[model samples]
Target: MESFGIVKAKKNNKIFVEFTRESACGESCESCSAKCAESEKELFEFPNTLSADVGDVVKIKTRDRSILSYKFIVYGIPLILFMFTITLSYYLMSKMFMKNIELMSLIMGIISLFISYLIIKGIDHKFQKTNKGDIFLEKM
Candidate 1:
């Protein structure tokens, strides 16, 4: 993925850029004004290889594969785990306990969702350490 931003500061090889944050609601919702109240610009420090200077407009890019994997980890895995655990727990409860299967399955599904969150946190930590300098910058 690529985005354009203005460099706000420089320290060694790192450049701090300010870019507009994209709204998930697409700025079309009339019922909610909370998103509009939030700041639009977000700052990030990226390792600069392009010799970009403060006040320069630059293009930043991240690998598509990296983004895809991140999305899968953040959104996909937990959803699948939640549904799978619900069904599996219900089935097992029906066979073994034969009582309160619905309640038990709901509880198990929530537990599985929490476990998925922990797993995602661990994965995110590892990925951050290994992919610290994955972003690239180019002067625009």
Candidate 2:
């Protein structure tokens, strides 16, 4: 993905850029019917490949592949885990216990979902340490 922003600060090979939603909003405000609120500009630091100085307008690029993986991790995994756990727990509880199936399934599903959250948290911690989703400065 690509975005344009103004450089806000510079440190070594990294620069902070402030991006406004207007850059990505192509339609005229008056013509749009969607309820849109003006949002505050967001700032992000990216690896400075263009040697851009503070106040320079720069273009930033992030890999689409990286974004897909990130979205899957953030939304997909938890959903899959939750559904899988619910089904598996319900089936296992029905067969193994043969009594209080409903109560046991509900309990086990919740417990498994909590365990999935812990696993996701561990994955997030590892990714944070590696700076895995960093964007790159493409132009100035």
Clashes of each: 0, 0
lDDT of 2 by residue, 51-135 (tens): 8889999877788887888789878877788778778878887778678787776777778778878988998898778964566
Instruction: Estimate the lDDT of model 1.
Output: 0.87
Q: What would the TM-scores of all predictions be? A: 0.74, 0.66
| Residue 94, model 2, lDDT | 70
Candidate achieving the largest TM-score = 1
TM-score of 1: 0.74
Which pairs of residues clash in candidate 1, taking residues 3 or more apart in a chain or in different chains?
none
Q: Kindly report which residue stretches of model 2 are placed more than 4 angstroms away from their true locations once superposed.
A: 11-13, 22-40, 47-50, 98-114, 124-134
The C-alpha stretches of model 1 lying farther than 4 A from their native spots are 10-13, 23-39, 48-52
